[model samples]
Target: MEALNLNVENTSSKKVTKLPPKISPKHKRINVLEEYKKRNDNKVALNLVVVGHVDAGKSTLMGHLLYLLGEVNEKTMKKYERDSSKIGKSSFAYAWILDETGEERARGITMDIAITKFETEHRRFTLLDAPGHRDFIPNMISGAAQADVAILVIDSTTGEFEAGFEANGQTKEHALLVRSLGVQQLVVAINKLDVVSWSQDRFNEIITKLSPFLNQAGFKKDKVIYIPCSGLTGENLLKRSQNILEWYSGPTLFQQIDKFEPPIRLLDKPFRLSVSDFFKGGISGMGGITVAGKIEAGTIQIGDDVLVIPGGEYGVIKGLEANDESSKWAAAGDSILMTLSGLDILQLKVGSILCSVSHPVPVTSYILAQIVVFDIKVPITKGFPVILHRQSLNEPAIITKLVTILDKSTGEIVKKNPRCLPKASSATVEIKLTNRPVPFETYKENKELGRIMLRKGGETIAAGIIINILSYNS
Candidate 1:
């Protein structure tokens, strides 16, 4: 294992200004905070993840919205329509705009996260359309980790909503997952109401049934908004169905999107970017590998030197792109594609963290965490095998020790050395990553990097935050 190198010569408290001779001449010191502020004034950046159970029409809804906003032109949309019709999936025309893969189109379900960029009147959004099937929960969790706010789409047709919201469904799991990952604002879009003749009662009934569960899942009532719409007809999406549904006078889906407040960013902290996806850029005529992720903290610009943790590889930022436009710099809360130079691409992995060379995140194999057990069929016992998920990485782990059960509200100890952890319980436990050391931080240090999810047998058993690093490679 490679240890973090802290003796790299610059010995400064701030970001290092000295660059290697391999770096371009543009590598110089400037106040990145001032530049970020100027760009932020025009349009606040927000990451929006659309999640729900399978067949909720998530892709179609967002695809139509993109077309309405002119992100998808008529010429391209017409091709999708004609192709979908020939394949006997005419209703999936709009969905094809985001679900571009032949596999996804053939199966008629989104298998992975499809990312696209669009702008509202007051906000610029990087839309993450996550997979909704139970088998793709890991993919959904990756998308949710980067989202600042979420849209929970539900099928409002008679028996559809009940099937998704009841009996161990993805609807409940997705809602809990996003809230566990620290998403506060939610928009519950009640879709397919047009199938039921645009009935207002159906919309209210669905909301009434879902409110208590969402509240239990950690979403506040005041922060959750409900809207009624038809993804197929595009009614109540960008415009109101005034003549048919006279009951709803609330804002449309697009209006509610603009109303979501952007979360506070850690602009002055040390730079950190979690790697989600990477590919060879030389295929596109670019020279190096391109990495994509949302900046979790601080600011990074072209020519900045970054250290990839757990492997101790160094790379220089050769270029940056945000919202499909070339940018010189990007701050926290912006999802960007970074082209890196002077580093071997093999060292970059999905779970790797790129940080300031002088101040890198810790690499830990053991941690003490406070976890809340979710609704599960079986109790979690000592040495229980599980998959630990954090950000974009999931690795095999075990509950090495069951320390004590704590009160969820007061944080006071209820029992010491509990034999087993039951559903809906909170406890402090020791976990060991069996695979390798991973980049981690305490919740007090950074909220985004500290959250973890535990899953077993295709179901999420618990979610928690790391409180202490028991053992690490430094």
Candidate 2:
């Protein structure tokens, strides 16, 4: 009787209207290069990552610089001073600006990358204050991956310089990693020189010892600039302190930063954006989801249809923000916030790549890469389980094959199918991701998307560049 009643209701003359298939808006592709030409030339954006060994005064130096630059107000600084003094750590007041975490403040260490925006006379800068501790090297690598230039801070205290530059210290490792990641220009800030009474001999000695190692690590002597400054006293940061160094003549730290040449923007390529972070609700209480990351290649505009790789979810760009300012379009190298229309928060995650539906980044499980192994206790062997880091993505992977070991000094093949890749060695190897496919491109195609880092036991073991996509299994 119930089935008959339901059938009667279905058969009752309900004029059922057929709903039309939802047609997504068709977007006309804009000439990104033409758009770029219309922009003002006064502002140049550059991402600068600060790196050095543990307790090298990296955070304090940058934090102090920000304070002096007026990014941090006097009231906030006074508050930090009062709070730090209560704990008998008044010296850490400036460091507290960047090391905002309670644990970080208490321990007096920076454990994660602190990103902030500041402006110079001629350029706008995205400063990445990376951790200097050995345990946080992975975090440092993540920060360095997004930088166009780097600032290597060094402690100038008599014995401290030796402690951080010798074996097991991160100074050498940080230099090699950044250079391998394609950071061409570097500023070496010899910090805390005031501790040694601002002696020129100490400054010269530190420079002489580090210069050879830096050059061997692929830093051009001319491209590297060394500045002696006291982070605690703010000497030679914004301007040279009077009567401190009558013998020396050079630009201040701010001048060096302003001189950094910006990398050529990849505006003509296909649009690709790497999702470094994601959140549920956007700027307003609107239901739109927001994803923050840098545009790796090409350009994206509001209302453009985008394809999220690996998951293959589709979405439309509802809003766009370049460097925290709302905009109609964003081009490569601009760190942006994108409000997406159709994707659920669950469908998106860090390391996801957003690309145009017409031209999307390839998703692959197996890749061929050219790697340079850092100083390690054991050689990297086949089938060795390691953590693979690409941008913000971290996944388990295995070294599938060692194709060939290349000479460190020259590009010639040293040996074919080497049994193991030793420390300070270069090789072309195949890597297999253990979990899911990742968005990747060849190194020659996109530097930002092609770089990869390998870690094991919380230590960075190797750094590499993708040479080819060996397999694309979904």
Candidate 3:
């Protein structure tokens, strides 16, 4: 919940103040206006989620990319130079960027998600670092939710995928969850290529095993891109290398990402912006929900009439900007921020929906969701009450019906009218909420608006891909 104090100034130093030109920092301005122009010219930003089993090198690849992209700050560089011997593993590069905690490094596991933005000449990638351990699967769900693409890291020398097999040998659970979350693009970075001597055999083996799992995870071949890399040695990330992975003719990690495209979505589906965070600036009009979305329809501008439907409230847009660009108006496909004139914080929650009053679908009870269970220490009971996360809102809901649980790997129903659902299963079930007015929909109908994360006892137990909404006759 900590916003980055992102003060890039005061980075002056002694040794860093006089490094060689190549090693010296190349500062770049992050202007929203230019980015908006590019977007208007059809340049879109891509979000890539770096995920794999713990220590499979997710952090390292991120760190390597950041280093190449000149994002590792001067403070971190000094910290590394002063304590290089104390640092462990190549993945520490990315881990440092995200796992900024003693416990995270000590345990060598990513528990929460950290978002970082890195730019290449071809594209800008927003990295979502998801925890690799099974215990932190909910964190993974939360991270993957924002990603348009996923990069699954596989350690070649281990001869198996990162993270061990689930209780039922469903090591592919993360991949399944990624697909279920509506991330359309996939990239498998067979990391530690140096350890395997960049053997095509090992890479092919991993891909061979991955392809069927990708199928089970419901990913298409054209959508999946595989690359061999070494996060430690920094190969095949930003450049076309002459190293052992020459047999691979595919693009560098950057090229693959730069070419990525979010699947076809209905931009005509009406403009909806869900507030994810709020900051009480110096004044009320100055502070509103921090909303993020590529404008779907109509124009959002300063002083525009924006109805805070969830609050039954009304507000005037006092400010409008996207990607830091001073856009007079943000229309369809422009990711921007808009401030409200009036509304109490209570009227909005993390997952509340913000849309045109004409197209209002407020939060409600009795949600019918299609779920994919990634973790199960025990079965999900019929009456299990868990939390649901959407937008910035997280609310409590109970499983009113077990309904039908489908084994996606087999494409068949393993249980009918089951009292409890087992591990790593996909199902379509009726989830009745304790509260009315939770905004949700069938994921198939609208991915941006239709997904929910399931949390229990303050822990994320599962995530549901909403499939249908049933009317209440009350």
Misplaced by over 4 Å in model 3 are 1-38, 72-78, 84-91, 100-111, 159-162, 165-171, 240-243, 282-299, 331-337, 371-381, 384-386, 389-393, 402-427, 435-437, 453-464, 471-474
TM-score ranking, best first: 1, 2, 3
Best by TM-score: 1
RMSD over all Cα atoms, model 1: 5.2
lDDT per residue as tens, model 3, 136-165 = 776676567666788888777764453343
Q: Write candidate 2's Cα lDDT for 1-474 as tens digits.
A: 000011111111111122322446766666655666665376888889999989998888999999999999899999999999999999999999999899999999999989999999888899999898898887887778788899999999978889889868888888877887778899999999989988999999999999998887778889999999988999999887668977679989999999998888788877888888899877555568999988888888877878777677777787888887888788988889888887867878788888867666777888888887888899999898999988778889999999998866665778999899989788888999998877887766676787888889877788878877876644
Which 10 residues in a row give candidate 1 its minimum summed lDDT?
1-10
Worst 10 residues of 3 by lDDT: 11-20
The per-candidate count of clashes, in order, stands at 0, 0, 13
Our tally of clashes for model 2 stands at 0
| Residue-level error in angstroms, candidate 1, position 303 | 1.8
Writing each residue's lDDT as its tens digit, candidate 1 over 1-474 gives: 001111112222223343433544566666789988888899988999999999999999999999888999999999999999999999999999899899999999999999988899999898999999999999999999999999999998878888888887789989989988989999999999889998888888898899998887777899999999989999988897569779988899999999999898988788988999998883236798889888999998888988887777788888888666788888898888899887788988998999988787888889888888999898999999999999899999999999989877677789999999999988889999998988887776677887899999999989988888886675
The models' CA-based lDDT, in order, is: 0.87, 0.83, 0.63
Local distance difference test, candidate 1: 0.87
Give TM-scores for every candidate, taking all chains together and pairing residue i with residue i. 0.93, 0.92, 0.76
Superposition error at 274 for model 3 (Å):
2.5
